[model samples]
Target: MSTTPPPDISFEQDALGRLILIAPGGTRHVNVHPAKMFPLTEKDHWISIQSENSREILCVEDPQTLPEPSRSLLLGALARRDFVPIIQVIHRIVRMADGHQWHVTTDRGDTTFEVETDESIQNLGHGRLVIVDRRNTRYLIPSVPSLDRVSKRKLEHYY
Candidate 1:
């Protein structure tokens, strides 16, 4: 970890909920987004600051070291950017020659995604599961055992 001075990070939102970033160069009206350089391992240590157009502005080496308000603001934006709906109900899991189809209900609503194979569902050690679809979107099943009996039975063939 760098012991260097922390970069000034701050933010504001427009009427449409668009983000505005404040920096030493002055406030820039950007659709700024927070991207973790390491999503699973480091979590909050390194982050990429990108614009709405997906352009990289800068990378913060450590968020925990930022000044109080700045740290909170950056973390809040990161939290929103990292939103992933949890699958609560697995209505069905269909196996196919090419791929598998999943019909499930998430915290957000009902949705379906295709998984290329049973390998797509990763057993994250313990009861947790993470399913990556064909398009690369991830559906988090926080705990496999916590799922309803029907979902567990359907998920058995995969893991």
Candidate 2:
């Protein structure tokens, strides 16, 4: 028999009435209001959570920006069993030409892995971007509209 403890599990209800699940070594933020559960799989440190309603899968590359409420819920769930949080912030997105090869940089370190893409490269969006860190950790990033106008040149010339 193995002595390793089982993964942690917790659930939260979002504004949209979806129940999200946060598990050890992985996070599953689901829209369960529609009574659907999507299976998320992790391979080599990369985690992909599929959407049952739209057939869309979200790939997370960072966990630090994860909202406080979600993180708190996840931490609470993990703490139930005496395990500590191991996931951290995401560094950057690793762009690849081939669909199979990919990499993600995180505060912990850089992790390389493979994922089967259903379509061509897609943009995260303009409002909030969800990312998964090196440990299959999940987080969200705010993409405020005003940020689009801000540039490195603007900051450098501000003085």
Candidate 3:
């Protein structure tokens, strides 16, 4: 059996710099968000262009298949939307009755947040780690081996 290719959806910003999704379905979807369907694995593929009202304007299988201008526009929006801080150092981790309060220094700046469970700390296949706070803010530890001895020692208790 054979499968046909996906639609050729065009994307461009309006006069006010707002994303416009010109879907093959002929609807000009405005206020669209280019969200990755599988960010961890297919970081560049399987994108869902949705509207402000949660309507799917287009489902792109491979961004590379789209026109360069449209692909670049969607990729730029996805980069801005998924802004997870890269944790550089673990300053402190205070264990409390309900959860642990983490004080870490990220590439951006210093930050503090609470982790409700050990499950919140996920291993992203590689040495990379992603810590999700109680409020659902994600912090990325790019590499475990890249951290200093002191920071690694502080994080070992939970590892």
Give the Cα lDDT of each candidate. 0.79, 0.36, 0.81
Enumerate clash totals for all models, in the order shown: 0, 6, 0
Q: Which stretches of candidate 3 lie over 4 Å from their true place?
A: 1-7
User: What would the per-residue lDDT of candidate 2 be over residues 1-159, giving only the tens digit for each residue?
Assistant: 111122243347677645575545575757522111211222122223334464434433322234667545433433342311221333333445644433443344555544344232223555433334334434323332333233212212111
Which tens-of-lDDT digit does each residue in 1-159 have in candidate 3?
Answer: 111144446888988878888766566888788777777677778888778987665578887787778878878888888877899999889999998999999988998999999999988856788899998888988788899998889877555
Top of the candidates by TM-score: 3
Clashing pairs in 3: none
From the highest TM-score down, the ranking of the candidates is 3, 1, 2
Candidate scoring better on lDDT of 2 and 3? 3
- C-alpha TM-scores of all predictions: 0.68, 0.25, 0.84
Candidates 1 and 3 compared: the better one by TM-score is: 3
Whose lDDT is greatest here? 3
The per-residue C-alpha lDDT of model 1 at residue 39 equals: 69
Report residue 37 deviation for candidate 3 (angstroms). Answer: 1.8
